[model samples]
Target: MKKVLAAVLAGAMLTASMAGCSGTASSSSSSKAASDSKADSTAATSTASAEDEALTCTLNVWGPAEDQAKDKGNWLPTTCEQFKKLHPKWNITFKYSACSEGDAGKTVTQDPSAAGDVYFFANDQINTLISANALSELGGSTVDEIKSSCSKEIIDSVTVKDSVYGVPFTTNTWFMYYNKSKFSDTDVKSLDAMLKKGKVAFPISNSWYLPAFFIANGCTMYGDKGTDESAGIQFGGDKGTEVTKYLATLVANPNFKNDADGSGLAGLRDGSISAYFSGSWDAAAVKEALGSNFGAVSLPTVNIGGSEKQLKSFSGSKAIGVNPNTKNPQVAVALAKYLGGADAQRSHYKLRSIVPCNTEVLKDTDIQKDAMVTAQNETFEKTSIIQPFVASMKDFWTPTENFGKALISKEITKDNAASKVEALTKAYKNPVS
Candidate 1:
């Protein structure tokens, strides 16, 4: 979600003077959603290669918007420059834009002629474009190696009926960070009591609330992939609808009204909200927002199974892929291989505080020592990578957005929700992008 609708909103909201840790609904709301246009390009030196007659040229790279892009912090242009210094034979021209849901892949799909050698895109969309032959297959040997190194859940998500596409670099899941001083054990009796007195943070309207409530109730975002080794989008069907109904129940009750109002971070600073569900990347900022009064916990669990069940945080990562149509597939492969390894992952992890999924590098001493990094590793163990319906999401987002708006706006009633929601889901068609 970080690189889809969520990623676009993050870039717009968190740019420059706006930089801070907070969640938003679209690609423009935060600095985390990386695209291709934010890369800082160096005017090419155009030096002739010692062995070849052709001059070394820059490789065009696409990524997300960044608050601080100098020296390629978080954008491919900067990462490419770092690669260029090591391999002077390769020059990369980077462009970073916080792309909308399917646009990252479609940018190349729509115009194969106009593209950088490499592209950074959300995982699900990569499946679509890769299958359509828009992006290069990462070859047999490399794919096998990446498979062993990345999470199996994530690997399975981007793989279509059979073939695999794209590599993951970001796993986004929720963590419950709280201002410890405000909700000390003796002061608050229970979660219900805390909510009654306005002791919660995070937005009710955000998708994060689902896992929060579900784990609290005991559910997962995915169902078994089946004997064919395929999974179902279990989060949004009848069970998914149950999730919505439960949310409606919570917010409509008026008992939880005060705690559910507005963005959750506002409550954290006021001492009114003691705990919140947030992405791992935002923990440092959440700490700053709450000053010295905070403590971090894994996302809370909601008992949903017959006995007791816990909901885990979502897991997955963002990645760079090569355009299959590129005249320079070799360069594209090199770029992806580099970023997916330890050097770039660690540098980005240090500069931006984002989590890395590369198994080979995640255990590096620098990565393990950072406080935020340490916490991410702790929380990640509790999560399952939630799979969005490759096509169901396309069919789901708009109507779901509208339906959620109406529910939040008091324009719709649960009595009529079945008919309305069904019609809305029926309309959500998966895009081929």
Candidate 2:
């Protein structure tokens, strides 16, 4: 068990500048950890003891299909082999499966006892996993390494109360992508400014994408940090109605189009829309669409009422987590930490272009130069809020979606914005879930 801890420390000792396409064997080290003779000696002794223990177990690990694909570098099995080498005592047989991070919480909770011993999940699912007793809390040197290797915001994504339940590997959020030929750098800074000069497409009807407007104008969900359920949704009152009116006017603009069914990307491809909002998952498509004119940036400010307010996206992380029900609790926990460790993240980035959340990995010159990484990190730090994961949040989606659909259909005009916003607020407070 401590052998995993030693491996983490050793990985932290490797130069943070190692940003190459090496597999898990070439895991990068963090400068944040103390590098001393005593620590190195202890690490060696721990490895020796772990070899003596010689534990053998069979465990199941789960992640997205891309990670398991040989064409994609087989990130899962490759990293697993590296972990096994660190704990030579553990004769681990890993059973691989394709369960994307987005579906991990639902799939696991459906039959947690039978789910993978180690798995990947979107950080917003932390509360749900905890509620089902599916996620195990991390502690000791593993917890210490995690804290030292990630940003506070990244750490907060997997934290419940004061305990961390998962190790985040990459950020999850959307930002702005525009056509450089259509908008100047200055013009791209403001959504309202950009709209006047070029066609803009937004997924206004998406429940996930709808809150950016409300949040920009003093509205809140759950609570300030998005963890307080009793605080309910503060999307009513003057501020909320003001945003509602602004959105109504926005949707009615001749240059604006509601992005639906990949219509935004489609429009970008045909030059029908010069700007769109999305995440790294669309980077290739956007790049292919715009060629040399491609541009990506953190979300821009939106004018609401009489003032300019910064538009924010819902932000979180995709993380590696261990099932609390795993028979091999120690090994499962170790593997979870190893998979999300800095080295694994660097490899994931090199092999799959997954934007890493590990602070040390983010410092590498190559990783620093990636346009999509910059956009995502900037949004995480400056233009996004944690998406709440409390059980009560389940009630938020449908109502918000219905509200956005109404806006798209022009059912809520400036005249009816107040009443409609109030009704939406009520629905949030008295959610069906």
Candidate 3:
């Protein structure tokens, strides 16, 4: 991933710099046009109206270490400068530090006032932020603009109870990373085919990856959006048992390896493993291991009910949220919007190699040319399921992993699969207090 990150960063910087020049030229032409046009008076009136609504405030922001680092492109500062240029009346001063997206909710929940007015957070943290009243709801023109600018999935991921809570900047998900030398293009399309080549590493016992099986076989976790706690676990049903039986067969296969201890990379490096299911986080290491043979694609299809079913993986987004406790809620909301907007998402893709969630940015020819970004985008579009962000989902991980372990140990057979699944479902339904 870092290989692509460096490559994309170089390209993105060039693209951004060129775009900056183009923008300056466009602004100059617009000034000439304004001087010559009769509509100049109307445009001036509109500009004045916008300025009247403009705000003035200092915004303390939080994001990952990369966003804060000067040498790493300092994306936040650049974005703020662009935003300030658009709304010059908004006297936004930013004080930023390293705060992981996953940690934003906890920090705000613990001390709302001290938390940054705007912060980047993971989509899964939405429910927690909402429950704690730590997030401000975006409304009116802001909501309309976001809905128009981003993909539906991106918009839907941050919306709760018909209110948008976060501005999604990039998608976060997993896909298959394989060694092209070991498997041909056709061979990588099916799980069974990949397994036939050599050992394929996946964390089958981990709750995060385990849900893919049940989900592909028509199971629901929590509810449609994972908000209905009463919906319980639907994986224990007939469809789930069928999927479990199929997974048991693979678990029993000698080519299957559990990646619980993080040995998969070592195995790949030493030629003991040919493929693994993971996300962008593992890209740099895996690229070094496979070198020229490294290849990434969507997850392979699994055999279910005598037919091939596309293997589904969970999808998530890293988003920007406004603190409800901010002194200037409107400006904070505007800043959050600007951070997740098309230009910001493009900058993020260039600076951090993060997959942009903005629809227009995703369609960029440059972004489409990057194999890693293209593969991830396609996989999320066709084969990924949105992971629920509901608070009740906190109870799901442990019991699901336990169930996976039991299956791997040959404790869940075709005959007894239903019973074990039922037990696991019961556990998941009963939230951990």
Model-by-model lDDT, in order? 0.52, 0.81, 0.74
Name the candidate, 1 or 2, with the larger lDDT value.
2
Give the candidate number with the greatest lDDT: 2
Candidate 3 vs. true structure, TM-score: 0.80
Model 2 segments more than 4 A misplaced: 1-46, 430-433
Q: Which residue runs does candidate 3 get wrong by more than 4 Å? A: 1-57, 69-72, 81-91, 223-228, 407-416, 430-433
What is the C-alpha lDDT profile of model 2 across 245-356, one tens digit per residue?
9999999999999999999999999999999999977887798899999899999999999999999999999999877666555566667778988899999888887898
Rank by lDDT (best first): 2, 3, 1
lDDT of 3 at 353: 74
- Estimate the TM-score of every prediction: 0.69, 0.86, 0.80
Compared with the true structure, the alpha-carbon lDDT of candidate 1 equals: 0.52
TM-score of 1: 0.69
Q: Write the per-residue lDDT of candidate 3 for residues 113-157, one digit (tens) a residue.
A: 578878999888888987776776665455666788777887888
Writing each residue's lDDT as its tens digit, candidate 1 over 11-30 gives 24223212221112243311
Question: Which stretches of candidate 1 lie above 4 Å from their native place?
Answer: 1-55, 71-75, 91-103, 184-198, 207-223, 226-245, 253-262, 270-272, 303-309, 312-314, 369-381, 410-433
The residue pairs that clash in candidate 2, if any, are 11-29, 12-30
Q: Which residue pairs collide, candidate 3?
A: 1-283, 1-284
Best by TM-score: 2
